[model samples]
Target: MPMAAEEIEAMIRAAIPDAHVEITDLAGDGDHYAARVVSESFRGLPRPQQHRRVYDALGGRMGGVLHALQLTTATPDRGV
Candidate 1:
């Protein structure tokens, strides 16, 4: 079964309480998604690390229920 966009957003928000998360379903399929995550906690982190934080929020669901995620991460001032 594919994951719901709301479920993905909730998971990220749970991990990063202060984050602003936007999830989009690409190709009209729940398996393919694009997520924009902005958080103050990502201020000094590198791009890879920031992406990792969001991935970690998914709890290892990346290759299972969630197929593909095009992720964009940024800080408040950085903008999406």
Candidate 2:
């Protein structure tokens, strides 16, 4: 089954309570998505670590129900 953008956002929010998440459906298919996640928790993390946090929030759905995710993560202090 394909993942819904709402579900993705919910998962992220659940894990990172202070995050601001934006999810877009690219290719008009639920399988491909673009997510922009901003949180205070990411303030000191490297880019790779930031991405891993969001991926972890997905609960191992990255290559399964959620096929492709073009993720951009940032901290609110960075003006994202």
lDDT of 2 at 64: 94
Using TM-score as the measure, the top candidate is 1
List the global CA lDDT of all models: 0.95, 0.94
State model 1's lDDT.
Answer: 0.95
Quote each prediction's TM-score. Answer: 0.97, 0.96
Task: Tell me how far candidate 2 lies from the true structure as C-alpha RMSD in angstroms.
Answer: 0.8
Give the alpha carbon lDDT tens digit for every residue of 1-80 in model 2: 89999999999999999999999999888999999999999988899999999999999999999999999998997746
- Candidate 1 deviant stretches above 4 angstroms: none
How far residue 22's Cα lies from its native spot in candidate 1, in Å, is: 0.6
Compared with the true structure, what per-residue lDDT tens digits does model 1 show for residues 7-65? Answer: 99999999999999999999888899999999999999999999999999999999999
- Cα lDDT of candidate 2 equals 0.94
After superposing candidate 2 on the true structure, give the runs of residues whose Cα lies further than 4 Å from its correct spot.
none
